[model samples]
Target: MSSPVKQTLKWAQKLLPACDGDLNHAKRQLVWLKEKIISDRPGGAIDDKLSEQEQTQLEKYINQRVFDHKPLQYILGTQPFCDLDIVTRPPILIPRWETEEWTYKVIQLMHQHLDKSRPLRILDICTGSGCIALALAKHLPKDSAQIIGLDISNKAISLANHNLNIHKLSIRNTVEFREKDVFNLDLKEPVDMIVSNPPYITHDEYNSLDPDVKEWEDPRALVADEQGTRIHKRIIQVAKHCRPYNNDLPRLIMEVGGTHQIKPLTEEMQINGLKDIEVWKDLADKDRVIVAH
Candidate 1:
């Protein structure tokens, strides 16, 4: 007989078409569902066999994924980011791997460069689910950083706060979530670093995206004006108010939409007297993040 993991996946694939379906996505949903069901059970161990009840839960999740067209992350109610499982819901962007990749690296960079004696303040504009901010809080030196996540969506801000609370017992760093528009906000306290994974998809591109994405993820987190550079440019403009970073520390780090956004956004960064700039590639080798001080 196949292992329980295999049987569980086989069952889901039959319902969701995994053999030659949405490829990794279809497979991942099945795998994650199995893992989620197992981990959520009281006294359950990873090596333990799945119970009949677990299989029933998996079937329900499969129906949600296959018939209801809900994204797997949302169905799971969380997405792993760095070392934290960020709670996810509708209208708040689920954490993406690209964001997680850069975020993990950013935490490492902070450890290597930030002054340990002074309290670090980080502002995450368009914070969405607070994944980046929470990840930073979890990984950064204990009591070393104060993180604030800002979003215009009340739902997004509330969800961000919820994620922070979920990990509150373990995370010691100061973190807050506020509903504020980036375009019109006065900084009561200047931040040492500004990071964002703002909306960068154009209207045309957004319309072309899979209906599942449009239905589940928040459009305001994915679509931006000015051909996907509007929010990026605004972040660059806002970088001036942040405390400058030296010794290879980046004061401003923002996710962008590949090469098309690099030139114009970097030019705007330079216009703001930011002389040092670096473009970091995501795992896919796409220019995914721009760093400037």
Candidate 2:
């Protein structure tokens, strides 16, 4: 009842259960194998340099790792975020749906704040993979927006640079990446808005996360101290430092974990003099983002 290719995939699937390994991992490996076979077909005028035996060995090699828990994103060396393909390596957090939503919302808010004739400045903190900054730079009205992305990790900044180059979104004059800790950033000019999806998962929550995530994603990017309010507190504190001298303070938009995280962070923002603080819900109607003036 099964074609030869289908049978080959079945054997690989049986050898590696979807629960035991990532379901997507098995599927990707099969795709790679099929491509190789297709490209090497006889009389297709392609080099059959890899003999049939060698091809079989390559599939087995990929299958063995799929049988393990290696993340498919890491295996593929890339992930999709907000219509962009981003490079992902170890030590950089993979951008998630919530992060993209937060970034998109910031863009929407910025459009409301700045009219077509005025240019707006935006800052993105803890910019792993440069997803937030790059997405904003790519989508915002090119003539009226500037974006800066900052990350503590040098590796992350490097990857961000690569991605910017890849997308040709490098308005080298307008978009920039910097190596700096969120807690210690000092901007020369006041920005119109600051956005971040900082590390907010508590230690207990980190430990309880799905093994697929806990085992593969960067641990440092996921865990935070003091019920996951530590980084959130620091970002709010820095915003207080950057508050404009006159009436306007840069608006803040941050992605928090959920409703459970709303109260403590709201209180912290108020204590730091961040007025008009409010929590925004994600698509699921859970409290997923916080906004303050």
Candidate 3:
């Protein structure tokens, strides 16, 4: 008498014992099985009858994938970021709550600096699924904010565009996605602020990450050289390039890997002559975000 999803969940519990170490894998399997079975319902309706044979086949396929360590977000192709549903895939890093926290801080700072009458232009570097840019566009004053999201990966750009359309936000036009390396970017117009959650995990530490992450998430998006601040250093250097063109210095808000990264990053900021450098801690009291003028 149980629904198909309920039956699938029960089956997952039984078959996932061998994979007991990976609870995320087991949970993903359950969700995938439910979605697959529901999608196959007659007339695309969940109320439509599902034959016993159809349910059995779906459970088999889902169990196999789950045991293999594939991520649930990769299977579902969507993740939630600050109330926005974002499209995701293999090459992009799944949106994390820490990134959302830093993004909100950037928006708050933007409100203080940008004038009420003029439109505020913001740039998000290393944009994975366009979550930061899209979230800002959705929350900021519509009449005075414009956002642009840039990623080096074409796949990431496409996925971000897809999320923008799915949300049905008119900010799509204002929030453009492009495949451009943060190191080589040449900005024509001066942006009010530039924010990024660039790769800050050291290569050594990256190699030691949990299997679920190293196996499923994009490695490039997670790992970096020079103790994980290589990309962050590049972003700081590039911001200087924009200073000559725009009379006003742009503020930078970056999410760091850990408190250890603060020293190296602060030195980089000093070498680049950036002002007002400070570290912002997350709710956990760890220095997670770096803000500078």
Best by TM-score: 1
The ten-residue window of minimal lDDT in model 3 covers 241-250
- Pairs that collide in candidate 2 are none
lDDT scores in order: 0.84, 0.74, 0.76
Per-model TM-score, in order, reads 0.88, 0.81, 0.83
For candidate 3, lDDT tens digit of each residue in 2-91?
876776567667557535646566666665566766776666877434477766766566654556566556666677787787887886
Model 1 lDDT, full chain set: 0.84
Q: Is 2 or 3 the stronger prediction by TM-score?
A: 3
Query: What's model 1's TM-score?
Result: 0.88
| Model 1 residue 204 lDDT score | 89
Candidate 2 achieves a global lDDT of: 0.74
Model 1 over residues 1-293: C-alpha lDDT tens digits?
A: 78866785677565555223755566766677778887897876776566778777778887776666777778788888898888889867888999999999999999898786687889999999999988999888899999999999999988988888789987879999999998888887978889999999989899888756888887888999999999888877788888764566788999998898889988899889875789999999999999987
Which has the higher lDDT value, candidate number 2 or candidate number 3?
Answer: 3
Could you tell me which residue pairs clash in candidate 1? none
Q: For residues 164-205, write the lDDT of model 2, one tens digit per residue.
A: 888875443267899999767766777767788888998988
